[model samples]
Target: MVEIFGIAVSMDPIWLTLEVAGWTTLILLLLGTPLAWWMARLQSSSKIVLEALVALPLVLPPTVLGFYLLIILNPNGYVTEFLRLFGFEGQLTFSKTGLIVGSVFYSLPFAVQPLMHAFEAVPQKLLDAAATMRANAFDRFFTIAMPLSQRGFLVAATLTFAHTIGEFGVVLMLGGNVPGETRMVSIDIFDHVESLEYDQAHLLSAMMLIFSLCVLMLVYALNRRFGVKVG
Candidate 1:
């Protein structure tokens, strides 16, 4: 048991939550960067459709998303079967992997929306100048676009990490409560509440509230400092 302010509590969920948030943020940064770049540069009428798809998670309920993910990652589901074709023999549902996947999906908008705005805010003139200097698309992106959008990257990563840490419904539905394997802080708090452990629940809930407030404050401070608009 870990003690927080003289209250006994398990640290497993805390560590697991950090691990999931870290992995989700890293994966989102890697994948969202390219997707955001593409979306920012899109000039076709289909851009709206693609943007809507990317932003779907924002409007979609976490439980609904989680329920679908549970189905897809189940033993006999398409995702599990697809992975089996590559010699993988592990289950996704009720596992840490499932939590990370759900977090990534649930927090996709937090990662992509900021990044897209940042990429879009990059000056076309700068990219055009880079092109005149024989810079390839990759070079222009890595050098000019990425550097200009540094604040956006910060916003995206911060929001994604914070959002993932606070996830409950999606994680619960997809990963269930498997103790050290899949029980996150949110679920742990839920368990405490269910078992009539108000003291423990209050402690955990207060911690979450404080942590969430701090994260939001930090994001807002960054937005002000860098003049980046995060939505």
Candidate 2:
């Protein structure tokens, strides 16, 4: 029930936005890490195809992605049907969970690319030395690569979370603007504009701009400090 610039805006949208972004970032870290590791080491034609698919969302229009997701995630869509076989009883469409799924897909490239760079930046000689010591892949990844790639982790997480905040069309298509559920700040801003609530729109827009700037600044500051420590 908080008012921004005298335009009433619910905190629910803010919380939901964070919830979706949080889930998206968490999932990206868990899944994108191993995928990025494998991508860094891969050297094959299929790697090119996989990379293209991962990067598609970066270049593709949000509406295009949202449209396809809507089809695929509908209650009777193939994906839902597959889930139903495992005791699922709900549709992904129009739900906060749907927003998270869409956000993860939309932000996949941001997470993966940073992590791939980080993983690849690990010195080959160090890995080779570890191999000579009979250190397995798991051990090397945890003990060597992970430590050296902290910057990449930070970059990936920051980029993914920020990108999720800017999502609009995908969430709109998949989750609508349902309050206390799937509504995000971006959608709220849109609702304000559509309702001719310019004051609210301006406030939300300025807040997002400031928040994004702060996130970028923090990332740069942390990266600088980490680099000094590494050097």
Candidate 3:
């Protein structure tokens, strides 16, 4: 078992997992909400394709996803090449930023699906009523659709955070387990397993399992409580 500053670093995995999870959730909320709302309201024939694309990460192997990310974000790759045109070096792979981007994609379905369902549940009559009251699109979203779908937002945030916490393949492929930078709990657990530190692995694994359960329970409880409130 590793020790950091006199504390069992194995136990520290919880904190590390929570930190990444929290950030990943925030990113999803900030970005996914608009996308979900758009998807929910869209009547276009392309909506199905777009939603499938959003859900692609769930089915794609993390290693395959990571490999493509590597190709796109490498020092000499598309993103970096674009940056190079502006006299900047954008090194995304094997970095903290890369880990975050990969986590967002990895957990996107969990975030988008719930929000989409929530938005879908909003009665079109409510939006029409808002429009009759001279409410703009933004006003309708904020005052009508969003408030009604708050429970789904809560569930999405919790699930996305929890799911990102356990991400291993994408993080390993993109971040390469660099300590204190991109080496998160899942990677740490893998390292421990490789080193044959069974006890450490057990401790970390147990902590993650417990944390995930708690988060999921919280989601269900909150959704149930507020669901009643909404009703």
Candidate 4:
């Protein structure tokens, strides 16, 4: 970062990426954990429909997600008007908050899939045993399910963070390339490339590549260690 023409120039988008991705992963984990657990245990006819809705973003084009969010979050949009009753104006898009939301939607699969698998992997026998011992649902979840699913949780978190770090279209659509706020690493690289700044683009790209590799490696190592422990 440098001060140029009375404005700060930041070449490091990693911090911003982490900020958006971190909050996104945090929110996803908190929200997704329960939903995933519920979904995993669900046996109703609507299970497939709900599962498809949750996984829709994975297959949807990032641009499509961004475009719809952009329209819905515009100042005069329906959602914005709905928020006006509370003495607040809608300003989700074109800000860091929108960027985070975009990241979360884009990275939902990274958060949900692992958790669903984790919940599924929990032995029904153990849960039955806990229930027989008079443990409530919450107790069973905390004592038996969560602890055993630590590896999946870790992997989900790491992948969500990494995936969000590389987000571009959604961030661009929602954030509009605002620097130091919504211009995440991927957007930064895009800006550099557009400006013919190959060196800067390479620097940011390399950082992203390294960060993703490290996160994946860490997740794998943890999974291996936990697998051995479980075995």
Segments of candidate 4 deviating more than 4 angstroms: 2-12, 87-90
Candidate 1 all-Cα RMSD:
2.0
> Model 4, 108-162: lDDT tens per residue?
8889999998888899899999999999999999999999888789889988988
Highest TM-score scorer: 1
In order of appearance, the predictions have TM-scores of 0.96, 0.95, 0.91, 0.91
Model 3 / residue 47 / CA error / Å:
1.3
- The C-alpha stretches of model 2 lying farther than 4 A from their native spots are 4-7
Give the runs in model 3 whose Cα sits over 4 Å from its true position: 1-7, 10-16, 84-90
Better of 1 and 4 by TM-score: 1
- lDDT string for model 3 (78-175, tens) is 78788778887547788777788889989999999999999999999989999999999999999999999999999998889889988988988988
On the 0 to 100 scale, the lDDT of residue 72 in model 4 is: 80
Per-residue alpha-carbon lDDT of candidate 1 for residues 1-231, written as tens digits (9 for 90 to 100) = 977888899989999999999999999999999999999999999999999988988888889999999988898988899999999888999999889988999999999999999999887998999999999999999989988888899999999999999999899899999999999999999999999988889998999999999999999888898883522
Shift in Å, residue 169, candidate 2: 1.3
All candidates' lDDT scores? 0.92, 0.90, 0.86, 0.84
**Decoy 2 TM-score against native:** 0.95
